[model samples]
Target: MTAVKFLSDEYLDELGDLVTPDLPEVPHVNVRLQFHATDTPEGEVDYHLVAERGVVVRAGRGLLADSDLAIRASYRDLLAFESGELHAATAFVTGQFAVTGDRAKVLDLMVVLQSGNYQRFIADLWARTTW
Candidate 1:
């Protein structure tokens, strides 16, 4: 079987689509992800994504400093979770993911994920995983 890989950019794009419809009409929110490698010797990588008016306006270093939420996860773990091979709750329970910043925002994001549209999110994730 081919191993799955989750690029930070692809992950941000899929997450933006997943939450856009469910998010309130806020001005904008910046979210940064600091990905740490639990199994690799390499340090960590930072990914930034900006959402505005239910659209992703920016991603990568173009994102602003202030963020509504920040999350930490290993690349492998994130890929697994995105592919639906691992559940978010289970990942959290197993210490594979950690979230910080606005807890409410995180919860809202989760609500969106749990909603019926999650199927679309899963499809997008599958495409990215195989790409």
Candidate 2:
């Protein structure tokens, strides 16, 4: 799979679509995702992803004021996870990634991402897009 530009707005838009509508129906749940890459043209950078109650409240290039969960990973690791080349459990256990904040919410997000339906959706999505 071709990895999308981690800092591109187009990448953010696709990811926003992937997460926002399918988040677990929990009250007052908010998630913040930070994608870090050290070798980008602009030096180390962090891209932002924010979701609240199954809705993508914001997605761009900065952090939110407050978030219930924060998931951090290298840009490559994140793409691998998304493409199913790297399992999240393995990544977390092997120190390839990190999660901070509400453990329950983090797990919920994982469930959503790992679900069969979501996997199919992602496959279909990728088939239609260059990224």
Candidate 3:
């Protein structure tokens, strides 16, 4: 298990393969989320993930059509958010994280991510990911 560059094509491929489409034990909401990271060596990085009941079913690089939510931030900030050093809600309120699209979907996604199953899932991925 070599570490993969965060949000790189290989990383997205690996994440696409690893993410469960649905976690029956955890609450989930149907939504599509887009992540955009700026200020990287590669310029801007874009990825979209489709979730069916809170778990990612499809994750790919580039913009996704009709995403229910789009979240953007500097790569450094995103790194902190991913590592749990930055709380998204607080960051959003502080203007550190920018989010757009359906407000309901944003709230729903938050709920799903806070679930214990999702926490463990994120931890596993974080451990395997390279900064």
Top lDDT: which candidate number? 3
The most accurate candidate by TM-score is 3
Q: How much is the lDDT of residue 91 in candidate 1? A: 77
Question: Runs in model 3 with CA error above 4 Å?
Answer: 25-28
lDDT by residue (tens digit), candidate 2, 11-81 = 55565555546445645544665555444444566666565554555556656566666666776776677
In model 3, the clashing pairs are: 28-53
Residue pairs with clashing backbones, model 1: none
- lDDT (Cα, tens digit) per residue for candidate 3, span 1-131: 77877777777676666466556633547778898989976679998777676666777788887898898899899888878999878877887878888868877777666767667866777888887
Model 2, position 6, has a per-residue lDDT of 43
lDDT of 1 at 18: 50
Model 2, global lDDT: 0.61
Worst 10 residues of 1 by lDDT: 28-37
Cα lDDT, model 3, residue 73: 90
Ranking by TM-score: 3, 2, 1
- Cα TM-score of candidate 3: 0.85
Better of 2 and 3 by lDDT: 3
lDDT of 1 by residue, 1-131 (tens): 23334554444455455544454543433333333334422335566555444334445423346777766787678667767788877876676788767766654455434544456756755775652
- Report, for every candidate in turn, its global Cα lDDT versus the true structure: 0.55, 0.61, 0.77
TM-score of each: 0.56, 0.63, 0.85
